[model samples]
Target: MYPRLFTAAAFCLIAVASSKAEEDSHAIFRRAEAPKEVRAAVTCDEADDIITRDAFAGGWLWQSKCPSNHANFIKAQIFSRDKNGKDAKLIRFPVPRGTPLEEISNVEFFPATREFNSLFVNPEDESVCRTEARWIAQNALKPKLVFWRETKDCDGKKGWRVLKGRK
Candidate 1:
């Protein structure tokens, strides 16, 4: 009788321990569910995905995509005469909200100048190309936020030639 009782007690103890382990596992799973901190990290990563590095428009232009519903498409460029001496803001502009950045588009850069251009196409119809896209100037001239040096002979007194110009 004592042997039978001991066996029954041992079986009950094992069953209870197994049930407790299962509950602990469930608690761990509940704690691992995605929290608010994880969501903010995903939101910040999205901005870095907006642009692509593949060159277009005669291999001198880079393509950038604007956020789907933003009011402006902001692009910033840094330029320098030397290969790595210093660089300054070549141009910065905000293409209109519907700038056609999503479609197959191309940008043009003047070979030795700070002038840059982009061909905006109709979002609904790709065939209908628009030569002129009104871009809001972030800065009328190359911003002086970078290292300052003597003005080159090519540049007039304005530090850098800017084109808020139409394509």
Candidate 2:
């Protein structure tokens, strides 16, 4: 019985490893990971990287997003440079994760400048049937987390329209 159990466990581990490899290869699917753990779902070129202008400050914000499918977490890699324009530091901010299509979230930078972390829209908790997203504005002097106005679709999809860009 012990040998059989060991064999079964080994098989399960191999199967899990193979499945994870498959997900890694596929473009749409990403190996499920918890929030704050960084993983790339798509290639760097496919990532919607917002390059900040030199007028304000030279830096870039790469929001890890697929052109087609949206991931659970707002895995954004931000870089805020010094005046010299050298590689200052890489500030990676991962927003709270949400359920796959049922509960969606989005993040938009204010002024679209070379600054890090403006605002983010996400459900307070993914497990519950919440309507509004927790709109957090870090750019303001006193950062506040508020709920966005809710909108219901014909298909019973509750979504919050925070920023006026992207789906």
Residue pairs that clash (backbone atoms under 3 angstroms), model 1: none
Write out the backbone clash pairs for model 2.
Answer: none
Q: lDDT per residue, candidate 1, 29-79, as tens digits?
A: 121242222222221112333322221121212223333323234332322
Give candidate 1's error at residue 28 in angstroms. Answer: 49
* Candidate 2 lDDT: 0.35
Off by over 4 Å in 1: 1-76, 88-90, 94-105, 112-114, 124-167
Q: Find the candidate with the highest TM-score and give its number.
A: 2
Error of model 2, residue 5, in angstroms: 88
lDDT of 1 at 131: 33
Q: Model 1 — TM-score against the truth? A: 0.25
Total clashing pairs for each candidate: 0, 0
Off by over 4 Å in 2: 1-60, 66-75, 83-105, 112-126, 129-167
